[model samples]
Target: MGESLSQRLQHPRRSLGDRHRSQAEKFLRLSNQGEGEFSVNIQWAEQNARQALLHDFTHPENWRMLAKIKVLLADDIGIRALLSDLFAVLGRDPEYVSQLEDVSLLDVGSELLNAALQNDHLDSDIWIQSFDASDVDSFVERFLKLDLSDPRCNVLFGRRLERLWDIAGSDVCIHLGKVLLSHRPQNYEMWTNLGRAHERMGDYDQAWLCYDQAQSYAGHLTVRDDFKERMESHFDGNSSVAWSRPEISVRKDFLVTMEKLSTRFSDSVIDTGASNEEVHVDQSGDERRLENMLKNGDFSSAFFLSRRLVTSGEMWAKEYLEASKLALEGKDDVIIP
Candidate 1:
């Protein structure tokens, strides 16, 4: 209880309303600041902004801020103009801000005070609008699936994706990408996308960090090497298997020597930044290997496999149950080489 979970969930208990409105405007500012200009989808701009901002953070207080903003701009030709003004201030301003304190939250208020900056701001010329309400709604429905944890994964989309790295400077997309990496450390796709973005930025070391962090497994040293080898082999070629060249193989005994390796991570190579759940759910075991074992009726092999899992005390894996049952049945396929 280093921080009270309740305090971690700090919401104002007092009402300082515009008679009692409190300074809730501050929360909106920080949320948008964290996101670096909430880019709206012109036609479905209102819907997109509402959901994106709402889903971006899981905190209840953040959602309350979104609800309040929706109430504030519920009317209008559309919230597009007002939203644009908010984003204009949101642009170039977050960069200078330090420590994410509370006053800059007021910058958003400066615009809320102005009614006519609405005309000064323009809709993205490139965003097409549609007359059908459902079309906009449907587009937003798909966007709802977009994982906000990784900005680069989604921002580097369409042709805009290709030109993202070519922009005037680190635009909203890049800024959000960094925030995502720093904040959502447990998200692999977040790390993967950041690595991809770093590749675009030509910071190979940083990019490699992203890749290495994503690629690491957390178990035995020998098995980790085998996993790494398998991962490297995946990059062998666009024309073949790997993308790199070897006049010949490096660990001359790579084949025979590396056979004594564990396929799953233990603890040491485990990257805290990656999700532990992802390691087991989607590691690099070839489907062909599992399928062949089943096809060859390698029941003892499957039994021993399941035995390790059961003894590992992971309780939830049904694979462990099946293995125990197979061992009870005395299958003969397993004879470790």
Candidate 2:
């Protein structure tokens, strides 16, 4: 079996990161010494710096080293993107965002990073790195206290969860993905990524649903069709067996379960003890809520509520669900769900 989540969380491979950082610094020094081709040494340095980050993203030094290398290579855009990623990891503080206004990242990337590090060093990635399993409740408490409403922050968390999936399991990835999607349902790429995670975990039914959502959001995308093809390929040459989408009821159940799991960690969810299914409102109120979600371009939430109402035998909800699907497909003039 793979290492447990607690064990992996407790050890962020700092030693490996240090080793790679050392190697990167050595290569950088060699490049300056002119012992060999400067480009070759810089290439080696870049490789090691990247490995260092892959091993331990929490280390601010690792990020700085990579940013320095990008500067040496005159990759201004790369440096900017790196800084953006760091800001995302830092929860996209307004101050940090403002510091970049009318500024050239190529010249001030390092200084900006330093300022960010000084302003607030309480990075969730760093917390994950230094996590102590002795107090599991404390760890959970700290995690729950994070602001998860930021899309970039959620993306950063989703990427970290993906990297740790082998040790932490696919459920974590699924939960994080749902949380991110709930905030930005228009991110079809993330939907595809979530589908891939589900596919890896053998949750084909859930995978199909995710892919379906992705395709619905981007009509030209073929991820859902590609998934179906892959499924069919597995049963080729078998006349009796075939792959198919789950029944509407099964899909609805899965969505509800996923929504509950996501809301468990999401700060946006209401504090009420009632689950979505348990929250009973008059039919008019439900319709108004659905309409408001559609007006706000919250297609994912609108889709879920419409589907739930349709499953409960509300014919009006069928129209809303179809409208939601159309809006998700990029139809601008569709009625609000």
Candidate 3:
């Protein structure tokens, strides 16, 4: 019985290894299709690399090959995503960490290192050296210029914007915000962040406009109302050029009053988790809150929370995170379910 069980386990392992190697070879062949020039069909190579990772995520060779291809293709976002995944996997195992030391990254440059470096303390390192760069603007610039029909990719770019905001502050992000808005004018989260960035730079007029646009585009109640309140506080009820619209002021006052009243009744208890079905319902409810966080442009919270859900085997959260990743590569139509 022990021998039979061991053989069954080894059989699956052998099959997975075989599939991973086949896919890796396919990736290499396609990646070098036009070795001396740029005529090679790189898309096919990318697809195979993706397949290789799916078969056996722990394979360092596949990670290195894909990283090289992503660099060659100037797919900075793809490289970061690849490295991030590789580190997430390999960082957990000591043997894999040692193997990572021998990998040779290609010419995609230090931007990859910069990304790893910036988030290194928080996550994986994979023995890759950090790049000497002031910022990840080059990668961001490349990402912004690409098409963004995929909603999940839209969020990943939002992560880039978040990083830009953190490293360079609001001035730099405002411009990138404009570029993103030009493509996705209805992204309320982008509008809110743009408004905040403009506010930080003391560009009140632009800030007011962004805030107003955010309120208009907000599909969620919490975000839309928050924008309204921000506009009021910024203008301070001075109905001059800043307060050209009467309705916005009314909304601000009404929401502020409502908030005050809600706080007064905030001590009220809300029952939860009374039964198995209720516990399941609560989980679903928590997932909805997570969805709202993603929609509200809170990528940091969404990402961390998604990580927890992934460990807990929440299929929906996993799907959402995967869609966001696929969106980074511009490979799918991510509707953000």
Candidates' TM-scores?
Answer: 0.23, 0.50, 0.34
Q: Mind giving the per-residue lDDT tens digits that candidate 1 earns over 63-117?
A: 3343346544443322333333233222312222232334333334334423322
Who is ahead in TM-score, 1 or 2? 2
Give the clash count for model 1: 21
26-80 per-residue lDDT for model 2 (tens digits): 9999998998999999999988988886566667788889888988988876777
Highest-scoring model, lDDT: 2
Q: After superposition on all CA atoms, how large is the RMSD of candidate 1?
A: 21.0
Residue 39 error, candidate 1, Å:
32
Q: Weakest 10 consecutive residues, lDDT, candidate 3? A: 3-12
lDDT by residue (tens digit), candidate 3, 212-302: 6566444332544565567677677666656433343333332222222222212322222342223232467656755664555433334
RMSD of each: 21.0, 12.0, 20.1
Show model 2 residue runs off by greater than 4 Å. 1-89, 92-145, 258-285, 292-300, 307-337
CA deviation > 4 Å runs, candidate 3: 1-133, 222-224, 230-242, 245-337
Give lDDT: candidate 1, residue 123.
22
Best by TM-score: 2
